[model samples]
Target: MTTTATDLRAQAERHLRALVGRDDATLYDDQWAAIAALVEDKRRALVVQRTGWGKSAVYFVATALLREQGAGPTVILSPLLALMRNQIEAAERAGIHAVTINSTNSEQWAEVHAHIRAGEVDVLLVSPERLNNPGFRDEVLPRLTESAGLLVIDEAHCISDWGHDFRPDYRRIRQMLAELPGGIPVLATTATANARVTGDVAEQLAVHGGEGGSEARKLAPQPTVARPAPQPQEDVLVLRGPLDRESLSLAVLELSRPEERLAWLADHLGELAGSGIIYTLTVAASQDIAGYLRERGHEVAAYSGQTETTERLALEQDLLAGRLKALVATSALGMGFDATLGFVVNVGAPASPVAYYQQVGRAGRGLPDGARASVILLPAREDRDIWAYFASLAFPAEQHVRTALKVLSDSDRPMSTATLETYVDLSRNRLEMMLKVLDVDGAVRRVQGGWTATGQDWVYEQERYDRVAAARRDEQAAMLEYIATSECRMRFLREALDDPEAQDCGRCDNCGGFTVAASVSDAAVQRAGDRLTRPGVALAPRKLWPTALANLGLDLKGKIAGAEEGRVVARLTDLGLGQALRDLFRPGTPDQEVPVPLVQGVVAALADWRPRPDGLVAFESRTHPLLVDSLAHGLSRHLGVPVLGRVAIRDDSVAPGQGATNSAQRVAAVSRRAVLQTEPVAGRRILLVDDLVASGWSMTLAAHWLRAEGAEAVLPLALASET
Candidate 1:
């Protein structure tokens, strides 16, 4: 009288057939195993497989099966909007009504909620950030937690701090998993988790729901309740398999400079198999490469975090339709951008092989029979510097966390992020991330207004962070080794993800297969070099003082009247001249006369000015006094202008490198220290010169000093800028 395993498999295959819009469709053996674990045992499972391995079909089929068994709707915590779009369509094809409530769709929420209450929705999708939304967390999520048929965490590697693309919001999934009712079917899925990340996520998945879990409610902002302790729970069923795609061919093209990399891409993009993505490590690189490629007659666009959502959608559609050769993108184009992409070219190597695997998986997913896809890497020497810059944004130091917790614990009312920013010196994004992590750690909570400490005895977990950082360094070393490895290229990447069945792919460049020509024509190199060498960066002056300067013992606020338009030879993050500037400004580089090429770059910038400066003033750099002074005097002589003297450091207590911190601290350090000592500060348009203008506060406050001393106007110039 009982339904057999064969019966369940038949039912699952029917669901799959409906999902894929064909009667002959069937789940892979691994996919069927994942679905059976969820539907039969009501167990928690973690599925780590390669991309295009039918991870989504497992869930959609299980959703249809569970819905038909009289369970409530399945709940999926997807990481990207693009993934939600893909899944909703797939669910409908299986005759399972699906709905989503995310940032992009507010107008449909009431209707969607009505459908859910009416039992018309079979699956519901939301981003991890929505899990912590004050309204959604308090109102909508609690209901879904208690009654959901199945819980799915897509892109599950993000939940681990050790993962390359760790997001604070994904950590909320741990707490959510702890709050889910026991015996409910749960699934966590990712395509790029290594052994360490896989173990971390699996450990979190075994935690059972607590009876009296803490709430993220807005209180009177006094003391708050501690987060609930997790109880002992069941084991997680882990299904991991070989991470190899037969359709992909991997190769590394080592070039010495950015221009060579750009030239290689330009000379060979058309020769690539089909439309795909070109990944970069920074937004500046994405924009610069996109611009150069467009000039070379490639129909391409740059995509990054700064890109508008609507425009990203349009670009994705264009790339899908093959109207564009590729998108020059930062990591923003990653994680759930499903297309039948034919190639993925790395402009610069990613930080880890795990991340590189995820990016390259985007290619060859939808290729036709027996046709292989290309995945190329063009690594540069600047990669480690860029990596270090991102590493600095990791969890704040112990003291910073103690300060923030103290402020939150003492406050009478919930402080908004802006108000908290006046006290914490961390940047806004980093501060918010720290708070989210703390909230998950039970040290803090994000309430209606902003954040509040939970009064728990929170410890910094220094050893764990150190291990994570060390793992990151290992991954970086591995990535470098990947470029130099004489072994099979695909096998190297597969083993990087800890694939047990990794084997020689036998078709990579090292395996005697053909790769694109590493050599570029001199004409192409010359054109790329010309684009990189031409450099003039507009520097917008600061217009207002940062808020709550009094807290830092300064009285400045409101409109900053003395600041004006400025120029720089180029940004230090620029594609072409950036390396030259970065080298000259390296930490131990000697202070000396400016290089002739840099001097020429400054001259080219000045030639386009409307009103040339009559005088030049240098910021007496504690680190590079000779360089700053020489550049200022050299420009003065070239323009036949007067030398007005230097802005001396009045308060040596304010370190020269303080300007690299957050805005409030940067302004605080310089506001009281910059003293214009020149005798000829009156009735002259002074050209302010410095070694760099990283945060603009140094120039703003120095110009404030000059304007305070009755200078008519100020125009700033720097050898390099970072903003």
Candidate 2:
């Protein structure tokens, strides 16, 4: 039976009133109206909206209207089992007959299949992982195909390789549609998707638009009759920015010590009343921190990969019901989570800016006032250095795709952790992660023995993976560059992602001027003559050494002893005494100021040091300071003004006139002057700096920092090549 626009509208209103209330019918926005029109026309559609923008409501209303008018069963494919359960419960609450097929159903699968075929079930919800079930494909879907079926693929971005979360099973969706009796109309919806993913969905669905004329002409004639008109691409609607939540105050804290960080968290929990989530990187970290917080009299629950699905569901339910004050979780907590009353706190730097944004999005779901998001930086120098380094690296899409493919293909047979690592170059841990994604996407099948590539079309799937991987890599690289930039973090993010209304968030670390001052400078220096004798210390060893002496740099000496004859041990120890050896073997902390250990007569000898035939040199303590000062002056002149300052000074007594060519000079030249300050400017040009170009880590970090500091443009500059 054909339906008119007016008829569909009246029917939709009645359905909406039945499900929610007469008041809720008026809540349908203009976007929902547009979506309803598409459903009335019986056309496939893709709805792209931000999180909490009511995409689900629109679909729910559309499904109800279609069912009331005797439209065929509406099948919803979700990514998570929890999501499936939620949809079923919501449908049941609305008086709609809904049934779900998930991991828990063994005895009920046959009953559910029979019910769908007999048209007894109006709405069917299932996880994407279950689509490959032969029972559904061969028995139930065939009967449903006799009537026009409505298929809704929620979280549609999972189908795109470029999306943050990609699923291999998403690719199987097209095949599933083709196998059905009458081609079912599909509605693909997602919270995020750029141009590339949008195009991919259209191509996969074989949907044609204005330029392509009609979808029929674009497709080759097949034995099966086409069912309905393909949906046109809808324009992406971007909402206004600065989703400022008036009730919550966002802040960032830079803690000086680990213990202090815990204390700060405890104090904040004591002060804040609302529920909250603390996000950490690892499961162990989340558990450890949650335990500490609980010990401090704060009620807290931990959520990680190790948490059982049942337990996690219970904990989430408890949090939403206001039974739990706070929860500590890893990245897993954000997806499909709906808690309208709370804040999100990041324990350390997120792996990427996208991740940070998604986690923060958890708050302010439906509240009139927005929610708060905070990031806390720890005190350790190593933490700072590591974060800074991570901020610098570029994420190239092609490289990641190639790496993922190589890993996937290396395994002759689909194997899990232990066996897969022997064939793939990736670490066992990383391989397992990719496998999980593949398993979700239905690209691989899991059995008692191991995993197998169940995807029928390997070539096309591989190409899809490549394209999406490349896009992801490009996005990551661009994002990294944006963050390292010396501009307003908001401006860089907005410009890069094409978000027009981005303002100075005023909540970032740079915007808040939360950086602490360095405690020391010129911490330590090694002599130039000492470096020549200990060249091995300066270079990484080619062979592995015993773990005991690994950090002390003694293993290389042992290797040299093995290479030599009876005098090996004695000769190796003698090398340490040489001027070159002493210079290169010296190790010191990254602190700015290093105290020098005084030696009798060495200062006088170094004052008149000269070069020897072996490329060694000597210098006095006072002369060493004078030499460093002169070099700083020369650098200042070269750089136009006085950017250079005293970093370190080295003394040597092996030769009086060896000059700057010695090992000590080389080391000084290689060292970089770390930036002390960075401020965010609304519209200022900035230059990004990195220590080395390896993987462009330093460059990415510098650019991100620059953006955070409010620079308009950040040009990346690197000092050395990582390769």
Candidate 3:
């Protein structure tokens, strides 16, 4: 029954052949080393290699060998469900039974669990988020970890807060690892980690047995005592390989304008070797670019977190099967599979060099006819601004954390996120991420009802957080430097990733002296310009009052009785005129008559507006009140409508400033201020105007007051929406 090293190799070779469905398939040197370390030595391994490196092969083959030696199933933690789908198929090809439990497959979890208990499932893939799922963590995880023969952490860079894909959920893996039965082999793999991230991940992975993760890190808040010297860390076998790939030809097309970038995609997207990806920084940008490309006769689709799971899967398949020329996507379409991905075009530079490398790694994975992928970055001036926007969402201040902790600690019962928002000042996503970190820190616990405090001592690691923020800023600067660099593009990225074997690939545009057509067609530019300039976004009414408003002492709940959809001239995030409009609303802009161009846009909007307003009522602005006055009066003359009057807000000194503050707080702040000083709106459809709409509450409450005052209909309209 003893399995020798030679015997393990023979079995692995057979599994590899079956997995790849190639008769002569053999393991790469790194793959074999990783496999041997896990299957033979029973050591944790970290495999840092480029995409298409067959990292999966190492785990699958090792699974087969380990199972033959009477080990239990391997549990693979994958980032994306799309990746899980591919992994399952690949495991099936190797005759290994694999099942996934994720958000999309909740209906099948029962069946999967039964299969696992029956020993029919040889491998199980799960999302990292599942580690913190109250039910899964309390019930399923303990049993799974007790019997797990091997643990595979895919996209392992996500474990490092310093990595481009740093996921708060992935941090819980350390807790899972701590409780995992000793001698269960663990394998963590990623294609996009630099030395800093690599060391960070390795250190986390080396948390010896039951005392896991950082001894005590950021994410938690309260107070902590100084710990004694840490014990020696466990040894993790590190398998790192050169990042460069022969199949990828890196390039940069420096088109400074959004129009030129869209033009470039439209002009040459079809000529790209096969279906691929077009990355944008925002969901709106993805949708916008996809629509523009389709108009230009290229078949593409937008993929983002906003895309439904079913639609995302369909779009992913279309790109993989060549039904789509590309999927214009946000980072949400993370690491989807495509055997013939011939290119990866970045509409704007990624926020970091590692992010750029990770995104570009999606291309040239495996191309038919040996066609090299065109990895290009079309960076715009707005890219830095976009990067800063994302950067601003990093860790909140200690005071913000303390505020949320106070709210939770005082609550006797678990509070849902929406309810918590009534007291906390953080946005939904940020609050949830903070809670997850706190959950790991034992400061709070998410249960069946919602989330409750544990009163466990937690320390906010200020020094560590400061370092992380500094690192993030450095990455952004490096991203800027990446686009500005005239040297070898691939070398720049590889070096940025701290790939020890970094060298000029000799295929990048800079090294090969290959210049792609940088000039955009005038007609294309004009069309793109038109598309960017013609802006109007539907402003959705805030239908439901935020839950637990009682906590805020407002007593508002349920759906608002009367709400109607409205329109804005543009979103604050939109390109073209939106940029100009945004500048006008910034902290120090002059309060004068709104520009003629914007006035013309508003006039055009008014011309198309239905249920024509009998009169205009401008909402008082907290900033740039003159602009609103000018816009309202100018529209009044243009529409030949009477000015009803102005609406004023009862000032609340405690109102939080508009930033990343939550909806509940916005509602709380605005609810105090709806004082109608306007003319009677009885029997008339009133036009509710504002300088800009953010959070929609200002409009919501204002419109409600008008409707309550007997307006037939309150039609909310704004110059821009901060969507």
Candidate 4:
């Protein structure tokens, strides 16, 4: 009853044909050819392709070929919940026994464990986070070892920080694999990875064999020791002509103000006549803008990290079904979302060029002509400042490496903030901003417990830190050079990432001759200076003060005796400011008297006040002086704003980017009306604010309740950077 090699091969081919609906003789492309060669050679291989380039097909074909040769079930370590679900669904449709194990299902986990042990599954898909579970490694993976398994790590780039989708759990997969007794052949596949990332994957897998080793060994050489083969001229495929996506057109509009940006987006969506995506930077912002759009009669959907998975799936299905015409989402929507969106709009500049590219890429999926994409630049000076800061940090440097290490080592526990002043020599504010960049690269963890170190697997030996630091410095310098060059932005991005043969993408700003002007008028510059000098201007501090001192329940004298009340007022004005001063004043109440009055004034000025249309009222008194201190410090240097007194107001009625918009005066009429309408609830108004807002959902929701309860005006404000 045993199957022979020929029988197995024939059966596997038939199964694959039925699954893929393609014939082998249909002429494979170069990517497929390369994959087939690796499978034929029977070696471990790492394949890196571009997004949407059929990487899964290569791996699936390889899987079939290997299984025919007597390899056991395939184990795919994926990092995304959506991706795992999609793979499981695909497997089921193809008649393959595939199961995904994660934290979602508590009751069925035991059954899944039993299935793995009994070898009833052909594919076991799991997340890197799930892989860390002790039960999975001790009970499940060990049992699979009896059958030689094909271990495939999808989104393998998560192992390296240079990759866009970095995950700390992915970094540990190498050790996880090593713990298993059998030398199961590992295949790591990703759509994007630079030279460093590719190398890191090989080293972590311990697949380093010299160039002369087995094909797998050659393909999966140690990243540190491996020298990339000279890129073949013919191997470079260039789709360099003007992308005449007749279905898509490119446009850029200058928005005069923040409100105007929202208006423009709403109008654009109305005119789009098809499904669209509006990419923003925060969940609150997405919700706010989506609400506004929905109010304006657009079928809008909002997607963010806080969104429930079931809701997200429902939204996606709606988008596909043409029931939802527009979606307002954070960057979280781009990875592996298979919607046929007709347009993509970025409300502001993306954090990185790669991020910008990825967001825009989401629009053109499966389009006959291709989808349109645009970026609407607002009139906010802060947007330009943010872009400049991003540009400066875009290039890696030795200082960044040092800062990263200090952040990692100085943390009392695993913390993600690399910019903590006590831990690094760099300015704390600068470090704080740079942390976002690192987070995007999967270099740090962002969790509610606090920022924790996530990507430890990519960290080389401390002894080699200097060497790696130096190499990174060079790489960053190259990136900087590319950014400054007048060549096509696409070309520059490719060159910066060591892409072998990047050609001009005629659709980009550079190729399309849409350069942002590099000159500032004296009048405009002087106006900026005058705005900076305005009273009540908010400022960001240069560095972050110690959290311990801020948390202490004492007066100002407790922390620093003889500190001027005015100095403290100007220094601390955000949510935690008064609390920090109060902590300093705890033991000595006498010293607290001076600080208490001064701190009270600062807190009151910064305190959030809102009035609803129905005689309802809301007040917030949680001012953190450090928040404003840091912002003021940063703004003073950049905007030359001589901020005398700063306050962190927690009002929901004030729209974001409206710091200078006289929110108190503007909301006065609505507040009085609301208070008069609902005298009973006027004394119990609810106010709300957050660290950042892109669309303004939190503000709107607060406003809704304030109006409902007969509260006074519901004011909203937020501290946020442009996209």
lDDT of 1 by residue, 342-362 (tens): 889998889989899999988
Off by over 4 Å in 3: 210-234, 336-338, 368-370, 652-660
Backbone clash pairs for candidate 1 read none
- Writing each residue's lDDT as its tens digit, candidate 4 over 1-723 gives 866545544555565565556576222354445344445444456766555455555556556666656667788887766667666665665567788777666678789878866767778777776644446544666566546457778877677645555554564465444444434566677655666666666556553323223332222212222223322123112111122223333344554444556655555555554687887655645766676667667898889877887897788778778898877887667655655677777665454454444455566555664444433232222234334443454323456555565566466675533224334434344455445434433355445434555544343334443543454445544534433455665565554445677666676554674433223344434433232221121322112223432213311112211101111232111112322433443334332122343334333434422112112122222333344344334433433423322222445454333321112222231232222112344433222322333223223333444445544434332333122
**Poorest stretch of ten by lDDT in candidate 3:** 222-231
Global lDDT scores for all candidate models: 0.84, 0.48, 0.80, 0.48
Q: Candidate 2 on 346-450: residue-level lDDT in tens?
A: 665454454445556566565554344333323221233333433333222344334445555555665445444333333333455455544434455555456
- lDDT (Cα, tens digit) per residue for candidate 3, span 594-685: 88888777866666656478998987766677888888888788778998987776664534254226888887777765577888888887
TM-score of every candidate: 0.93, 0.56, 0.95, 0.56
The candidate scoring highest on TM-score is 3
**What is the Å distance of residue 358 in model 2 from its true position?**
2.3
In order of listing, the candidates' clash counts read 0, 72, 0, 73
Winning candidate number (lDDT):
1
Better of 1 and 2 by TM-score: 1
Cα RMSD, each candidate: 3.7, 18.4, 2.9, 14.1
Q: Which of 3 and 4 is the better model by TM-score?
A: 3
Ranking by lDDT: 1, 3, 4, 2
